[model samples]
Target: MAAGARVMFAPCISEGLLLRVQSLLYVGVSVESIMQRHNESVEKQGGPSNCNDLLTHSYVRRQERVIRRSIYELDADVAVSINMWVENHQSHVFFDEDFSDVDPLTLGIQTEWQLQQMIRFGNHSLIASDSRFRTTKLKYPVHSLLVINEDNKVIPVAWIVAPKFESSNAHKWMRAFYNRDQTKDPAWNLAGFIVDDPLADVLTISDVFQCSVMISFWRVHHAWHKNLVKKCVDNEMRATTSRRLHQAVDNICQQRGSKRLFEDFIEDFFDESDFVDYFKATWYPRIVFVVSDSQWGNRLYQEFHKPRAGVTMRKSKKKEEPVLEDLPKEYYDDVSAFIL
Candidate 1:
């Protein structure tokens, strides 16, 4: 690598390491296999055979092929293979960071490396905004944005911040307006922006590119989650919420030379109306993923160990969970069920 680090094949992948990567780095599913699943789903949905009954030629073969290739690269990359993880429901569009598997020492390196890449060369716009949890009426609960690196550091390119805690009166009225329950999953309160170029696609790049980010940190926010109280924040006066870097980002994004998907701050999370129901984006999982351009791995292969063909997994001499043999095989039709 230009960074002066050379990776040598240390050993064959141990089943333990493979399982760790599958469960820890990737959350739990095979990125390679899942993308294959996604591509297959997209093609079918884009078909005249549309199941959702919507016409969408969104993922033609060429695009699917490109995505498939990217996925493979990530699965095989040293750095990426070592740190990425798969979470529940592997097909979800956004990936949550897996906090359990991360090694503390490398977190800084991984985070900074990724922050630099996204803010610098990866074509994207960063965003931030204040939002409320759906149930708690916790206004401007927590704000976040796609960290983009432009000045050689991962910084906010698009910034959004939540309002200070809404007054009790305001919260009551807000709940009444939305019929939200503070006890239920909170309302959706995240600010997101899109980049103007091909490389700017968030979900696509996130799955396709291998990054230096760890899976442990990106937990998905979910529906049905108790609405987190958005403790009132200090928003009386502020230059910009991109942590004092908004002006610079705005200047760069506004430049005729820079690429921007939407020229103005993304106001659609609230104004567009269709993004989600008013009940709240909270109480639901928020999928967050880091998209980057690097893929590296530290390989150390280990021998495969499993019971023989006739032996059930649970009954393997070690008494694992019973491996039922009667489950139906997943066919193409079954695989086509996840496109949304």
Candidate 2:
């Protein structure tokens, strides 16, 4: 962890634990598939970690208030996570790597692109304000990092995410406890731990809903890839984002287990353009796990979720009415023909 960087962590042990779980994945990110493979991977299962300790203190009248208050006190460069409320949070600045115009070679693990965005973060705020943004609220909290030209003073920035996370993970709870929208088939593609099977965490288990990460061989048109970069950037909230690349440093954070995040972290991107994109990518804890052990939960959040006296994450409520969902311009294409 970077000095002065804070890592905030929280475990979801609430009655709505599943909701929090759903909040972690982008639309279509599968939790059930992962669990299925987790079963086949671990042959030597041990005791499972206790979830009893995950519950918040009952003494706290407003638990949500506690969560909000926690954020208000966080220091800059703080890294925080909550398995219950939020999964991972990191902050870093990054610059593009110079690879002779050749995109960096990826490991044999095979990479794929999951998203693409042409709109910059600033303008999207208004566009996202539409009801479509409700589901995107939980999974991503990408904030832009700003610098003062005069003295180079660093300041943190933030923006609102419309559409919330509506992936398969989000629906897991509605189907389980609610019994209203369970997966079409219950036997496969489930997120809950089977408890009975213990050593099942070896395979990547990210095939079905994952974005196949691939190398980019051309100059980035931020406008064209803004959406895709933002998806990864939002997920990789903690990373360094800068214009200068350092050849001496290897991505140590990702080698151990953290997701491959850009060294650059963008709290906000005010410019709107397809040619320029900014944000960082990387995993939360940067810790590798031997999921074969039942104690995996103990380490599920090993490197994040800070409860230090002065560190936390924060959110502010706006009083505007819900944004309506109407297109700004009428299309010349025949409505019936285009509807199909």
Candidate 3:
């Protein structure tokens, strides 16, 4: 019997093949592709006429189990090392609870330098927080707390890895940074909190810290544009509608316009379209917070909407030729000598 058929007929997969499959999987190669490669290799070696039957889904599942077991074994050691490191750096790292106690782990890390910078630059400033996914194979959402420095550069103050991006998880993440004891600290001063999701992130920030909440303009603009594209008839109509809507949004976001102006613009430009109705129902109420002079509106405009200084290139003035009358007598003598 051929080696391929012998291996398949055996009760367990061969050690060499298992190792090869593990290596391929470790480097992100899919199981289907690996099976195809194995079948092609068997055919090239003339090992089996039914090369496709040599590799089966059962083999892939078995290899996956072995890989998982190996990873679990390694993770035990890694967990110990991580514990030791965290104990050594307790001031810079934080865990919501023991890993054994939580289904999905929640951990936050901030360096000493980052903490100092946050205190120095983040206090009474616009602090923004958001969540990002697909950053790792673990598939956990990474929550980040950031602030703008004196140079207007965005600096991350803290990061929390959590199971989900819900309001409760966000509250837990923020609580890791500022508990009830630290809330009274003067350095906890925050002008406003900017977030992508008003429901998930804003609920926690506003309730816990009692700070002004500002919705990200990019998210708002994206929603407006996406809905306009879906509701408009054609490219021409979409472009014209988008231009007028964008102007209104810009003015509102920049704190230069009011709800009355926006309503008037919508009424004058649009004639009872689905887009208009959606905008009124969904986003109209939020305009108060976006353009209110007393609260988040002014703070948001000050931090993000204000124009920044930029370097401008000026045209160089042409150098004027020196007049012969203004020239020294030696210059005229030299010119006359050269002519001769």
lDDT of each: 0.25, 0.22, 0.56
Q: Model 3, residue 158: what's the lDDT?
A: 70
Task: Candidate 3: list runs displaced more than 4 Å.
Answer: 1-91, 98-105, 133-138, 163-166, 180-187, 201-203, 223-233, 247-340
Q: What is the lDDT of candidate 3?
A: 0.56
Candidate 3 lDDT over 105-169, as tens digits, reads: 67676765556556765565556565542446654467677665554545566767676555345
* Best model per lDDT: 3
| Per-residue lDDT of candidate 2, residues 17-123 (tens digit) | 33322222222234554334333333234312323313222312244444456445244422222211122232111111112223321100000110001011111
**Tens digit of lDDT per residue, candidate 1, span 184-293?**
22322211222212112334322322211122100112211121113213333121222222332233222321212122323322332332232234211211111111
- Arranged by lDDT, best first: 3, 1, 2
**How much does candidate 2 score in TM-score?**
0.17
Q: Compute each candidate's TM-score over C-alphas.
A: 0.16, 0.17, 0.47
